[model samples]
Target: MSDSKAARARPIIVFDFDGVIADSHDVCAAACRWAAAELGHSDMPEKPFAELEAVTYEALAATISVDPERFAGLVCGALEARTTCAPIFFGVADIMMELSRDFDIAILSASDSDLINDFLITHGIWHLVKCVMGRDVPGSKTEKLLALKSAHDGKFVAMIGDGVSDVAAALHADVRAVGVAWGWQSARRLRASGADAIAMVPADLLDLIVVQELTEAPTR
Candidate 1:
């Protein structure tokens, strides 16, 4: 096989769904509010989206005083209902398609797999993705990352996400954690999370991957 073929056969770029791919904060926040109200916390004060986006998904559920597992189910159902309507960030499809040429793309999201799969399919970008590992998978992101690493063997795995949890999970799984500036969290927040690198925009992400090639040693 040529060098390009070998490169394409290895190295996976994983993405987080809601914030990273789909701009679904409002929808997710609405779901959270509805679930909180269902649990009799309707009076919960609203926080700024930026404030809410700063934290991890688990922390968000706890802040709303909803049982985590129940909140997850409620949010999943809400997202499923909104799957066809939620919009991904502009130019993301182009970037994904470009990267798909040299690297296998995958999603390692906190959202439900079926919902994400449907969303990708609805947007006509499902073929660019190699796999979807969502909350339905029986483990944390760290465990899922580990599974991906093991499954791909010698492939270099990189997790691209918008939250600190993603950085932590990727590092824990012994993979590279790349942050996106256009997602739920700010670039500063991602930097603080010890991300291997941060992409300022969808286009910058493509440059980062193709130019840097993510060949440096991963942070311990």
Candidate 2:
């Protein structure tokens, strides 16, 4: 890229949903089990998450002679609420508060858009975020981040998440890559990606995000 083009791609942050935003594994797993139970899938294990990865609402309902459509709606309704109701990782609130002072903050998540928005809105951080990188309402994660770059004027952009897909975006998006450990993937997995930086905790993120705007409130 030319120096002139490089100047336009600024440093900004993107986040992952689920584990990064809130510890939603339990909530999501429980919701799935509850939905399965409602469908009379007696075969479902008592474990909240053991079968969650394999059991979609449609599949569970089919197994129990229930209407998939109706059960899906029920699952969505119940789980969406849980999106905003989970526990925030320790020190995340403080780190977000501090980081917001410097960097251009945004949500670049692989999770569903409504889920991400709900989590942010419930926690009152929705207003703090200027943009969101949600997976396809009708598009992919790559599309969302590209759009985010198009909308900003910063010289650097960052893909911050706990997955390989996020690494792909960092490569495809032509920006620096970052990994966070408070999410689904392991730190070992992230480090293996050869990312630019790996944040073991949200508080560690402060060191990378703060540039020269410590005293200046980030552009809202």
Candidate 3:
């Protein structure tokens, strides 16, 4: 066996706030729905999430307009409202505490930082994390990961999210990626997107990140 500290330092877990930690699929879709209604689209195509995921807010907005900034403020309002309307997945707080005992937890999501902070405060679990990063940071989520890698002195980083953008960030930073079913993207789509692993429940996430369960995890 190794030093307890050494075992805890394998990978820094960067979790995306929206889909993975909370039911933000609908929170974000509410924004898109508002955007669609504004443009008079018959319906929001991303509602089903049916395997094809719209990753970035900026990218998804283009489907409705050439000038997305014009609608940014409006959609932000709806997303802010919807994020609080739903319940977060079960065991999120409990598992987050367990995960924090070993891994350094950071929040990196496409969500607006203000909203993420609000949700965290509302949930009373915000203080458990090491850092909170959002898309608004310089160069966005991908850039934030690069910065995190640089800061960690080249430790293996694990990016946890429920969207393709999260996967892209993990790949760009040369980190492992885990997608959770608790989020918006369907389980099938997450696998197709090349996630290293996908957890069916918040408790299942414990198997992958912590060394305590390494020998106990089911072999493929």
Candidate 4:
């Protein structure tokens, strides 16, 4: 088979790191609060910090009045130390492994790829993922999705995330976006953000992918 045909046969599933794969809400919240304090900003509300799981570090930094790069460095530094503390969600590993059998799985997230790589490596499923595109990738999630769309021209690409930003990016990129209910933002928010579907649980995500595959298969 030609390389192009092989690529077409395997669609890509891009996952968000925090909330979706790793239960890193606490780590993110801590990092945001720490960054705010370090920047001498007393207006960082706990609510926005919790919502930080759903936003890019640049957006969060702008809200707190700090340089984006510096804010990311501070947060990433804080996250690096708590890497071992964030646990992978229940059944996520099994679901990822199951998806890897048919799809080329990758990660596209706001968190640093190196940080996420460490977590994936420690969890022993690093080999299952094809690539990691994080904040270091030099664009918003929308731009990154557009790049992936261009790279995988003929194949279907889906972004699985727990945030509105994820859904919006996928929509803008013309890719499918699946929002997980267990993540930071509410399902209503994801839907409002135009998510194609919402997975109520980890197993539900796998089921959604399988259903989509069957539905999209060419009729012979």
Clashes (backbone N, CA, C under 3 Å), per candidate, total: 0, 9, 0, 0
TM-score of each: 0.87, 0.69, 0.82, 0.87
lDDT of 3 by residue, 58-138 (tens): 666675563566556666767766534445677888989887776677898766787877788888888877788765565
TM-score for predicted model 2 compared with the true structure: 0.69
Q: What shift in Å separates residue 143 of candidate 2 from its native position after superposition?
A: 1.6
TM-score of 1: 0.87
Residue 173, candidate 1: alpha-carbon lDDT = 81
Q: How accurate locally is residue 44 in candidate 2, as Cα lDDT from 0 to 100?
A: 52
How much is the lDDT of residue 64 in candidate 3?
53
Candidate 4 has a TM-score of 0.87
Ten contiguous residues minimizing lDDT sum, candidate 1 = 47-56
lDDT of 2 by residue, 53-90 (tens): 22234655665577877766776778766524777777
lDDT of 1 by residue, 75-189 (tens): 6777677625689899899999999887788898877788888888889999999989887788878888877765665475578888888888888787888899887777897
C-alpha lDDT (0 to 100) for residue 46 of candidate 1: 48
Instruction: State each model's CA lDDT, in order.
Output: 0.78, 0.64, 0.70, 0.79
Which lDDT tens digits does candidate 4 get at residues 86-138? 79999999999998987788899888788888888889999899889987889
Q: Is candidate 2 or candidate 3 better by lDDT?
A: 3
Ranking by lDDT, best first? Answer: 4, 1, 3, 2
* lDDT, residue 34, model 3: 72
